[model samples]
Each structure stands twice: as structure tokens, then as C-alpha cells.
Target: MPVQRPFNFSAGPATLPEPVLQQVAAEMLDWGGSGMSVMEMSHRGKEFISIYEQAEADLRELLAVPANFRILFMQGGGLGENAIVPLNLSRGGKVDVAVTGSWSRKSAAEARRYADVQVVAEGSGRNIPGSANTWSLRSDAAYVHVCTNETIDGVEFHELPRIDNGVPLVIDCSSHLLSRPIDWSRVGLAFGGAQKNIGPAGLTLVFVRDDLLGHALDICPSAFNYKTVADNQSMFNTPPTFAIYVAGLVFQWVKQFTYAGLQGLAAMEQRNIDKAALLYTTLDASSLYENRVEADCRSRMNVPFYLKDDALNERFLAEAKAAGLLQLKGHKSVGGMRASIYNAMPLEGVQALVNFLKEFEARHG
Candidate 1:
């Protein structure tokens, strides 16, 4: 039997599939007979270009990205995109944001620097505030932004919200990208960092509709300009080659993944649903632990829960670590525990975590 390795539940810079890690290891010194690793290759070299093309193609196919949307492999994480999105799409006009959690709140703050920022909807940081009619959406706004999944707050929008005004809808899906299929009809653009679910930090993915490309503000840098980056096939400046390579492998893995007769994105989404259900079920049953996010909005990717006794937090983390479950500690902003079950984390990993949770509660409850 293959020996078990530790299960990691970090929110970002999270776990990667063992097979993808192995493949990356095997290609460390030489990738497909190329003398240099992906990290060493020139960004403009044919070899790296081939890697870039394949990665982009695989991602487009896997996500079912529409023909009219341009896919960009970018640097800077979700945080940087907070500024980049406003610089490109805001057009120095009104920008409306739905502040559902920490990430979206940050997005609104960053955007205020470039546009007339308005908070259309505000959640309690735990629950999305209200229905669409309650959102004070402005018809003249350049775009409306939402973070479909908030990693820190453990809130998610199971169904993408509708923007009635035909204004573009931008989603910061850094935590849940590729875990499910996207509805292109409603989205004007989508962006995500490749860490939580895709592969690594430094790589960001942007999908922008054809019409949204050329409106970047005057201050937007050439490299950060979506139109410039898209025009150059994401090579306007040197892309994050290594991250893209690993993400490509992840995309391939997701495409071939199978579950309950579903394949690819469908398979991934179903598995994520099962994993989240398992952990949430365990938490709900335990008198010693509880998740605060509402049931309908709970994130399948990141789950933050609290132990009944805060004094036991340290012991819980240490015990979980010793049990081969890692990074169960929640974000510092929220004093509790979190389990980031990304695409790479198998059901077995979550089960191990569930078992550990039960044992810990039994001992300390």
C-alpha cells in the first residue's frame, strides 16, 4: 500500500495533486527533453510558448470558456487584480460592488482609488445582505463586481447573481475557479489567482468578453492592461511560466477526473459538494464545534469553524497536525479553524480531517 502523506488544508498556496507534483518533480531538470526546467526557460522561447499555449488551451477547454472571451495568464495575485480590474474596466466611471466578505470588501476599497465606488450590497460578513432588488445597482456603473467565493469569510454564491442593467459583471473567483462550470451568458469577465484551486501563486487567470477589452484607463500599465496582455497572448510581459505549467497539469487532471458518472468540471463540482457536506455534517453534529456561515452560502472550498472553547484552539491545531492534517488553523482575522479543501484535496483527506475532528471533540467536548 502507498504510505499516507499529510493532508494540507491551507487557504492559499494550498495542496497540489500528488500526480501533478510528481510530474513537476520529474521535469525539474528537463521538461520534455528541453535542457532547462520551466522556470529557466525564456518566456518568449518556443518551448515556453508551447507550454503557454497548451496551458491556455487546456484551461479554455476545461472551463468551457466562450469563443468570444480572451483568456490571459497573468502575474500578481487576486489582491493585485483588485487594482487591475478597476484600472481596466472602471474607465474612471462608477463601479458598483457587492461586499459579501473580506475579499469583496477589499475589492471595493481598492476600486475607490480609480472609480466612483459604491457598495451596492453589503453582507454581514457572514451572510449576503439581501436579494437583488435590495442592491442599489446603478445603471450607469461601468461594471459590478462580486467575489463568488470568499476564502476568509467562508461565504459563497452558489448561483451567480444577476446584474439587470447589462453592465458587465466581474467575479473574483480566486478560491473556486475551475471547481465548477461558469455561466458565460451572465458574466462579462472573470478573474482568479491560480493558488487556491489551480496550481500556485503568481499566476492569475482572466477571462474577458471581446467587447470589454479596449477600455483600460490611461493610468493602466502596459503589462497590467487587459487589452495589451490579451493582444500579446498573455506575453505582453513575461508570464508566470512555472505556475502556468503546473496549472496546465492541474487542468488536465480535472478534465480527466471522474465521479458518479460525471466527468471534468461536473465531476469536480460534485466531489467538492460531497467534501464540504462531509465536513459541515460533522461540524453540525458536534456540540463542541460550529460553522457560522449560513448553510446556503457556505463555501465548498474554504470552511472556517470555531471550537466551543477557545482555550482548546492551540491543542486542536497541534493535535490535528500530529494526526497528519495540516493548516487547520483559521485566518488570523477570524479566531478559529479553517479547512481549505481545494481541487487537489481528495475526499480521503477530508475524511481524515473529519475523523480527527470527531476524535478531538470526543476528547475535549
Candidate 2:
């Protein structure tokens, strides 16, 4: 038997649902009796095509995606989409960005390379803007961009900003894609890397409203063109076959998930709520640790906290690993600790971490 794995808390390329992993392992050698692994199958082959179609369909159902939106499984993670989005949607016109934290700031910086990007609203790097009304969006802006969840900053937008100027709202939801239901009426495009909430790293999921598909900047690569990929059913070129297969299994697992009498996405949202609450409650109650993000904007997926005594960082990480809680270190820029309680992180995992935090604080405090 394999060694029991520790609870993973990495920011991205994060943990996946256990059932999805087990199914992937079981199908590694012979997927569906096809005598070939999903990785070995051709993207154009019928078997792989079925896997792609089912994954897209399941994701659509799980999220209740509107019929008018096209879901495209493309390459290039969130950072890549930072550029690809502005290139495809900006049309070399003004683009408004709401800088809530690190990821949104990066998105704004990258958009400047393709469009005349404007920082319509800014945060103090610890909280989201109080309201979308504070933004100074231009009427001619092609679209407004926001990172719905900042993995590094531990801040999430509980509600999406309303753009009343007829500008489409494009969100980089890399860290919190499937944790809960999305309001499609307020969104024009939402994209994310699969590694966090879905499956693996190479796959990028993009849901774009039909109206936003055809207006790519002339400099945009043909492969990255939304219209081209949507027209070909995300097969303008060879897709991420293995990642899509694993993601398909994850979607199936998510569809069957149940918690507290809730099912599917409702179940997932409930569990995530419970997990984040448990962890945050522990941190808030402890004098030794602190989570600085505003409670209203706290992320249900990533939780970044700092030890009151910064000198204890090394010892905390070492003991955390010994306690089977891994990857609790914060991002380099942040310099503390982060616990990414994604959809795959069970309530028990958060409880375990809480127990460890209490024990450590008691021993050290």
C-alpha cells in the first residue's frame, strides 16, 4: 500500500479529490478497456473526444453555466490568460482592472502590454474595494477585469462588481472556480487554471459569452483566439488530453458529492464554507496567529495567516510537516504561512490543522 499522504495546502497545482485520483490511477494503464492510457490516446480519437465532451458537459451542469456561454478548455494557466484575455477581448481599446490584490495587479500589468489598461479601483493589498461604485471605468472600455479570488492575499469577492456601462466583466477565477456557483448574468468571461479546483496544471477552463468570441486583436495568435477554439470545440489544436481526462473524473466525483443534505455544487459550497470557517475561527481565536483579510472578503479556498511571533516560522513549518500538514508556508512575497483549503480539502483536514495550531500555540505561548 502507498504511504498515507499528508494534507496538502499548496496555492496552485493543489490537492485534488481523492476519488478522482484513485480513478485516474486505476485507469492509467487501460482506460475503459481501450488498451491505452488517456495520455496515450490521440486528441482527435473518438475515445478522447468523448472524454472531452463529457468533461465540458459535466462542468457546465455542475456550474449551471448559461446556454449563451461557450466553455473552452485551452492551454495557458491564469497568467497566460492574463495576456490572452486582453488580446482577445480588449481589441486594443481601454480595459478597466480592479486591483484587489497580487493576482489582479498582475492581470492589470499584463493587459497593459496589449491594451491601454487602467486601474479603475485599488485596494490596500489586504482587502477588496468596498464597492464597485468606487471604480472609475471609462464608457469606452472594452471590458473590466477582476480576479475574483486572490490566492496569495487570501481575499475573495463574495459578490462580483457590477459594470453598468455595458462593459463586459471578465474575471480571473483561477483559485476559486468551482468552489461555488457563479453568477453568469454579471459575468462575460471567467477563466481559471484547473490545478486548483479542478484537476491538473496544463488545462485552462474559459467560459465566454457568445458575444465576446469573435473580437480578438489582430496580434492575437490563431490558437489562442476564442472564436477559433470555440468553433472547433476547443480542438483548434491538440487539447490537454490527460488533464482533461482527470478533470472529467473530478467532475464526475463532484457531481456525486454529498454533504449536510446538499448535493453537487451545493454540497461543495457548503463543505468549503464549513472548512474555511473552521480554520478561520481557529486562527481568529488564537493570539499566536492572525488572518488580516477582512472577514467579509475572506476566501473560502485560500487562507493566508501570519504567526504573531515571526521567528517561529521555521519551527511551525517543521512541526506542521511532522503533524502531516504539508505546504502550509505562505507565498514568498507574503512571508508567513498559507493554508489553501480548496474544495478537495475536507473538514477533517481543517480540524486536524486546527488541532495542530492549538497544540503548537499552547506549547510555545
Candidate 3:
């Protein structure tokens, strides 16, 4: 029998699927009788090359990405891409940004160093702006950027904005990459740090439409240029070998997942929906705790809730840890408690959290 582990609710570097972890452990010593661990294989050798190709292929199929889009696995976490994105897509001209929360705000700030950034619309920090109709888009802007899911603030875009103008849409989907299906028709470029929903840190995934390539500014680093990386098939420099391999395993696990008769990504989406509903419903009904984000725009992946009494914060965390629920503290920027239920989190884990919430309130209230 497997030893029971605590249900982890960390925002990133979070819990992975148990089976994936087991598989990693079983293969850690020697991968497929090659007499070498995957970590020890040469990236240029056939062993690692096959792993990279299958990972790329499985990810494309899982997301249903179009043929016109090129999926490039590269380095630089989401923050690094904040600068790399502008360097490649900004063309040293004008760019438009919609500041919904912390992550998008950072993206806008970074782009300003490379191009003239226009704040198209701004959210109130608690909720998304009403609509795209109010945006002040620039006709000459290179691309319009948005963070689809704000991990810190617990806000998500259920429906993507429709840009009638010619500007392409660039999204930072770091926190909720594979929880559901993406409408590729509406996206021009989508990038995410693999730590949240995909895999571990140090690997960033970029899916760029073909037309957007080859536009890196003269100041763009040769290695960071999108076209060059894509042309070489993401091997311009040695890729993050271990992270990519683990992510490939995750993709395979997602493909085989099943829930409530649904399969694969559809099943994953339904499970996330169910988990969020259970937690939010409990919070809304309780007088001791509440989620501050607007109901309509609340993030399904990251749920931030606060106790009615501020004095209970420390006691609440201590009790939660003692109960085997870990990492429930919210970001310092927004104080409260956050429960991040990504694809890897099981439904039983959420149920356990809900039970603890009620039990904690009963003892304190």
C-alpha cells in the first residue's frame, strides 16, 4: 500500500498526480533499460530526442492546437517571458495591455521598457473590467496582451476578448494552461510557465501562430528569438531535459484521465468545475469565511478566501497544518487564505478541505 501524503494546496511548485510521481520514482534509476537515467541522457542523442518529440506531439493533441501554430518548449519562467515576449513581438513600436490583476500588470510594466505600452483597460483589482468595448486599443499596436488567469488575485477570463482590429492576442496562461480546452481561433500567441498546471518550473511553453514569427527586434537576443528557436525545433540550446520529460509524462496521464463518464481534457474541466463549486458554495454559506473576488470572474484554479475575524489567521493556519492540509496561506500582496485546486488535485482533497473549513469554524465560532 502507498503511504498517505498531505493534500498540498500551494499556488505553484504544487502537488503532482500520485501516479505520475510513482512513475517518475520507478524510472528514476534506468529509463527503458538504456542503463542511464533520463537526466543523464544527452539531449542530442536519440533517447532524449524521442522524449522531446512525443511530449510536443502529446501536448499539441491534448490542447487541440492548430497546424498554423508552432509549439516551442523554451526556458525562462513567466516573468522572463515578460521581457522576451515584447522583444520578439513588440517590433519596438506600440503595444496594448489590459491590466486585470497582478500578473497582467507585471506584463504591462515589462513591455514598457521595450515598446510604448498603452493601458487599454484597467480592472478594479477585485474584479475584471466590464467589457472589451471600453478598451482604448491602438490601431498601430503590435500585439494586445492579457493574463487569462491571475494566480495571485484569483480572477479568470471565462470568455476571451474579441479584437476586431488587426492586433494579435497574447495571453499569459501560466496558472491554468490545461484545465480546459482553448479556442485556438481567438488566440494569436499563448505562453505559460510549466510549473502551475503542466509540470515543474524552468520550462516555459509557447504556442505561436506562424504569421507572428520572425519579428524579433534587433535588440532581441539571438537565443531568445522565437523564429530561431522554432526553426531549430526547440533545441537551439539544450532544453530543460528533466522538466520536459516529466511534463510529457503528465500529458500522457491527462490523456488517460476519466471523471463522471467524461474523458481526457473534458473530464479534467468538469472535475475542476465541481471542485470549485464545492469550495465556493461552502464559503458563500458560511459567516466565518468569504471569497472576495466577484462571483462571475472568480478563478476555478485558485480560490482566495478570508476569515471574518482577522485574529483567527494564525490559529487557522496552525490548525489546518495539524489536520494535514498544507499551504493554505494566501499571497502576501493579498492577505487571506488561498486553495489552489489545479488538474492534479483530486476531488477527495477538496472535500477534505471543505470538511476542515466547517470543523475549524465550529471550534472557533
Candidate 4:
């Protein structure tokens, strides 16, 4: 049997809620008397179709996604969408992107293959603008893309930007989806991989405005075309059946979540805010550990911190693991330690991490 642990702070392919995992385990052998594991079922079978429908419905209701937007269950992780977004939306026109950190930079570079990508705004995504007028958006640009949250740098855009030029705004909200409610009014399209707040790897969710459909460059694969996939209800190709089922369970779990008398994503959001606040506050107060990201722009999901003495990094990981906290290491590009407190992580988990941090500091101080 696998050992149970607590306080996981992994970046993607991250921790899942215990209840969701438990349900998955129980149904692994025989799903709903079908006598077949979900993984073994055909993607077109009744069991998988039921799973897909429930998953889609639950997600639509959870986000309060409008009728004008089609939710696609896609396969490629965020990296694949880096190209897909441009292929479907760019129309070979100029594309504008705000280069906040690693992910958006990659987006800009990939889009250059299909369109003229312009960096309208460049900075760490965390800070409030020195001046909003600094951006040079092209009136003829295909669409403006923003990361919204930089997973590696711990910078988050609390408010979505509004562009008056009529060009749609595309957001790479992969890291922070479901942590809080989205202002869909300002967003034209959004895509996120399910490894973070949703469920497991292999499931990608894309929400696109109805008016933006059917514009795919000839080079784009038929299965990847927004209109094609959306028209087929994400059946253009075989979907990630198992991952979708798990994500549906998570959606149900989120709906029943209660915090401060709120339910569903509202409750999840409040709890997430509280959990992030607790961890960030503790890190800020410690002299041994520090999070250098700007206060106003810090990510509520991924918190990357560093020890004043880098020599203690290995010891820190060993001790954190021994204390039942795992995957606290940061990304390789920006090395240190990172704590990803997504929606699945409860306030108690953050408290455990805080307690561990304090104890570690006291021992090494």
C-alpha cells in the first residue's frame, strides 16, 4: 500500500483532494457495474460518454461559463495550446502578448511561427503597472494574450486588463484556474491544464467565445480546430476519459465545499485566499526564508521562496519530507523552494507548512 502524506506543494502534476482520489480508487476495479475499469473502457462507450457529459456540465456550472463560450476537453497541455491558440486565432495577423515570465515568453515565441507576435507589455506579471498607458497594443493585432499568473515567478494579475481596440483577450490561466472566480467579461478565451487545481495530468480545458469559432489556419490540425472540437463536443479525437472523470469528481467536491457559510467555488476561493495568506505571511515574517515577489502581484496558488542560506536547500527538502510535506522545491529555471497551495489544499495544510517552516527556522537559527 502507498503511504499517505500531507502538505504537498507541487507545481503541476500536483496534489489531488483525498476524497476524489478515494472515489477513483474504489471505482477502479468495476465502474458502476460495467465490470470494466474506466481506463479500459472505450472512449466512445456509454460509460465514458456519461463521464464526459457530467464533467462538462459540472465544469460549466462551476465556472458559471456563459452560453456563448464552448468548453473543449483537449489533450495537449498548456505548451501545446501555445501553438494552438495562435493557429486558430492569429489569422496570420499581428499577435500581441504581455511578456510577464517564462510561460508567456514561450507563448510569444511559438506564436511567431504563425503570426507577427508583438510584446505589448513586458515585466514580471506580479506588479501593478507603473502606468497603464505603457502598453502599445496594435489595432490590427489578432488578439492580446496574457499569462494572468506566472507560476514560476509567483506574480498574479488580480484584475484582467480591458482593451478597447476590439481585439479579443486570450489568457493562459493554466496555473491559477478555479482558485478564484474569473471576470469572463474581459476575457475572450482561456485555457488551463487539469494538473493543478482541477484533477490529474492529461486533461486540458479550453473555453472560447462563440463568435471566435471556425477560424483555423490551413496548417492547423482538424482535431485541434476550435470549431471542429467544440462542434463535436470534444469528440474530434478520443478524450482523456479517466482524467475527465476525476476532474468531474473534483467539481462535485468543490460544489459541496463549505467555508465561512459559502459553498462551491466561492467557498473554495475564500479558503484558497486564506491558505495563501497564511503561508505568505509566515514566510514574510521569517528572516531565514523569503519570497521576493511583489506583494500586490503575488500568486495565490504557487509561492516560490528561498532560504537566506542556499546551502540549506537539501536539508530543507529532507526535513520537509520527513515532516509530511512534499514537493516544496521550486522550478529549475528559478531554483529555490515553491509551495503550490491550489484549491485542493486546505487551510490546515498551510498551517502545517507554516509550523514546519517555523520549526526549521528555529532549529537553524
Q: Provide TM-scores for the models.
A: 0.98, 0.99, 0.99, 0.97
Residue-level lDDT of model 2, residues 46-115, one tens digit each, is: 9999999999999999999999999999999999999999989998989999999999999999999989
Clashes of 2: 0
Please give, for residues 195-251, the per-residue lDDT of candidate 1 as tens digits. Answer: 999998989999999999999999898999999998899988888889999998998
Model 3 compared with the native: what TM-score? 0.99
Candidate 4 regions exceeding 4 Å error are: 1-4, 125-133
The candidate 2 region of ten consecutive residues with least summed lDDT is 125-134
**What TM-score does model 2 achieve against the real structure?**
0.99
Candidate 4, residue 298: lDDT: 88
Clashes of 4: 0
CA shift of 74, model 2, Å: 0.4
